[model samples]
Target: MQGVPYLRLLGLVVALTVVTSVIMLIPDWNGEQASTAAPKIDQLLDVAIILSSFVFSVVMVMLGYSIHRWRARPGDESDGAPLHGNTRLEIAWTAIPTAIVLILAAYSWIVLDDMEATASNAMPVEVTGQQYAWSFEYPDENIQADELHVVKDRQVAVEMRALDVLHSFWVPEWRVKRDAVPGAPGSGIDDDFVVTPDRAGTFTLVCTELCGLGHATMRAPVVVHETQAEFDRWAAEQEPIPPEQPQPAAASSA
Candidate 1:
């Protein structure tokens, strides 16, 4: 029957989609889930991968079948039967894809809202980006250091600013990135974002934007302390060393 071939094609599409989706999800595409937002971000990415794989499988299968089924035989130059487009099929495809897009858009919006939600007790950390280095300041502790340090399980609100040109603050494990502009509008130049590190480890922070000649060397270390006490100790250690006082020449010429 005519329906048999269509059903077989549908089955093939479904099978290939599943196989490809699993393959896409299986590898360690993301390095590690260090931040609280990692799980939600990963889930959203997985959904995207599944949808994309399904669409790809459907398109490829249909194209392959059409080519194989309608190819001209050797020495056959006669014109094929004339056919018109199916209005119902066209409407179905258009409506289905539009619906899918709307649903995904809604879902993505919700996820972004949740990820960017602010915390009441988030610690404020000032971030400064220069041509070849980064500096982090803990305003509450009055500590300034080249390395970023924060306590685990606490949300850190990073207020970022760029000293020279445009730069982007990115920590791959945190699953969030924001731009640091020099002189934009009201507070837009000083962008801020909250990140909660769930695990205690060191992560790499890099500037994604092409700043200048030393762009490749523009990287810093982010250390997530295991406890508040540990972070406090580290902050205390960062206190500035007192300037050595002049000894008055120690009774010159005694």
Candidate 2:
């Protein structure tokens, strides 16, 4: 009787959850995890998916069940019975969702904090983005290249800036993206971001933002070397950025 409806609702919710989770949450939805931060980001995504699936399942099941079980009978057109809100149920629903939101907020902060906490020995790479290309500069080594090359299992602090329009630096496997804002040399609208690449492979650095005419073609290669020796070897072969020539004695300062 009453218990039967509850049991059926529970079964429906379970089945719906399984099906939805399989469709939306599983099957490599977040793509490859190649950085230390990637796993944490992926875990957060999984939690979000699970919560949303359950909420959607409960709502849809209840809506359908109520429509079917309480439809008006034939020739019985009349005002529906007045129903008062259940204080306990309302409070429970409000409190539960509030708790879920708080939990998610806390988890999201933790992930960002962990990722933003740069290591003491992290390598620095200045990344510049133009309308249709990206460049990587290793200041310490005085190396410059169109493609990014870094050592695997090492943290890279990306000093990012845009020459013209806004650009975004995104490495799919890293699961993090940061915007590069256009600014003057020392105007300092900072857009610095960091990532620790754990995987040694060739990835692509793509601009997620719609910057302008050649936006679709704005992509560069990223190479993560397996060892310091490999990275050093590559670095030794690249052309160094030419040192800026000193301006002619500043026109005899007043």
Candidate 3:
């Protein structure tokens, strides 16, 4: 009967929806998402994508079947059946997409606002970029060095500046990546978020933007100190080089 195909289609759609949702229910937190409020945002976006995929798949399937099953047989092409429009169906489809888009846009703006608000109180750390090297400057201690040092449970706001050319500051583990532009207003500047280091170890800071021939070597290390004392000791070690070993005074006298 005609109803049988409709029933079957509904059953298939329901089955597919349930299966996909169940699969996405599993949470994977590498580290960055574990600390920030990004997990909720991620879940919302995932739902949107899943809904889109479901709709796209269903439409494609229906279109393919119509093209094949409803094709004219032999020479019986008598201008198919009369075409008709469904006003209610058109309104429903259009309104649903518009509502989803509006909701997503509002949610995204709220999240961005939260991030910028929290940035004001973050601890400042200056990040300097150059050919095959990256140095971190702690204005609080008047120290500058090639390696980055940070204490646990502290919020760090990095101000990145490029020495030679354009580059990008990227740290995958922290879910932070910003371009280190050259000469542009607000150029050579960016920030990142690292609330806590549950796992103490080194992470790579790569130059995302292509600078030059040594671009591959333009990488740095981000070290998360175990304690504030350790960080202080490291900071002291990087103090400006003392006046080159006081050269022996020439034997003047005579």
Candidate 4:
């Protein structure tokens, strides 16, 4: 009899968690999984969602049950019985939350490790972000292009840098974003977004950070080539960008 309420609450929480998690997982929450890093990252996010759903269910069920069961009755003024907190339940909640946090941290580390894993035959592309545009430079080919071109099934090790103000390199399909820090020569600007694009298609490279008025238009094309030959053919036809351009729109995304 003492455990009847606890059992009922547990059942309600479980039911709510299941329903919430299924509803949350039904949609393509993160868009198409276009990069090699997408699956693992998405999996990690799903785990978090499910965990959050369970936590939310617990809180909601407990709050509702307490409100209904322990409500003050509409009667004459009377004193309520004095009670102390349940030490066991308190310890349980603290320990459970700490354990949950540790589990999430461990899983996050694994996904991050996979995202940062080094790969052979990685392509290097310099990602430059300014107030209003993005420019991609192929250091090896010495070709500067407005479009960020990479070979499919290959790792694109992007070296990110900002010119005018702080910017961020974000492609939603890539499932990972990194900040482009502005720096002068020898200023130790070290940041990169390592992405292995599996799909061969064009995606938009957007600046997630708010830089300036033109920030909304600060977008470029991310073209993934199906083969090395195709990428080379396209690269061969592009002209190197001039040393400087006053109008950023002319050089890159307008």
Best by lDDT: 2
TM-score, every prediction:
0.87, 0.86, 0.71, 0.90
Candidate 4, TM-score vs. the true structure?
A: 0.90
The local distance difference test score of model 3 is 0.65
lDDT digits (tens) for residues 13-118 of candidate 3? 6666666655755555333542244454565567666776566546655676568678888979598667687687689779877886787788778765654455
Residues 1-254 of candidate 1 have per-residue lDDT tens digits of: 14439888999999999999999999878779899999988998999899889888989898898898888999999998877877977997898788878888998999888988999989999888879899887778877889999989999998887767898899899888888886532453548889899999999999999999999999999999999999988998995423552333432332
- Give the distance in Å from residue 78's predicted Cα in candidate 3 to where it truly belongs: 5.1
**Model 4: per-residue lDDT, tens digit, 1-254?**
15448878999999999999999999998998789999998899999999999999999999998798778888847877787878988999999899999999999998898789878889888888887989888877878888899999999988987877899888899898988887622466558758899999999999999998888999999898999999999999988756764554423342
The 0-to-1 C-alpha lDDT of every candidate, in the order given, reads 0.85, 0.88, 0.65, 0.87
For candidate 2, write residues 34-72 as lDDT tens digits. Answer: 999998999899889988888899899989998988899
Looking at model 1, the pairs that clash are none
Q: How does model 4 fare in lDDT?
A: 0.87
Task: Tell me how far candidate 1 lies from the true structure as C-alpha RMSD in angstroms.
Answer: 8.4
Task: Score candidate 3 by TM-score against the native.
Answer: 0.71
Distance from true location, Cα of 236 in model 4, Å: 0.7
Q: What's the lDDT of the predicted structure labeled candidate 1?
A: 0.85
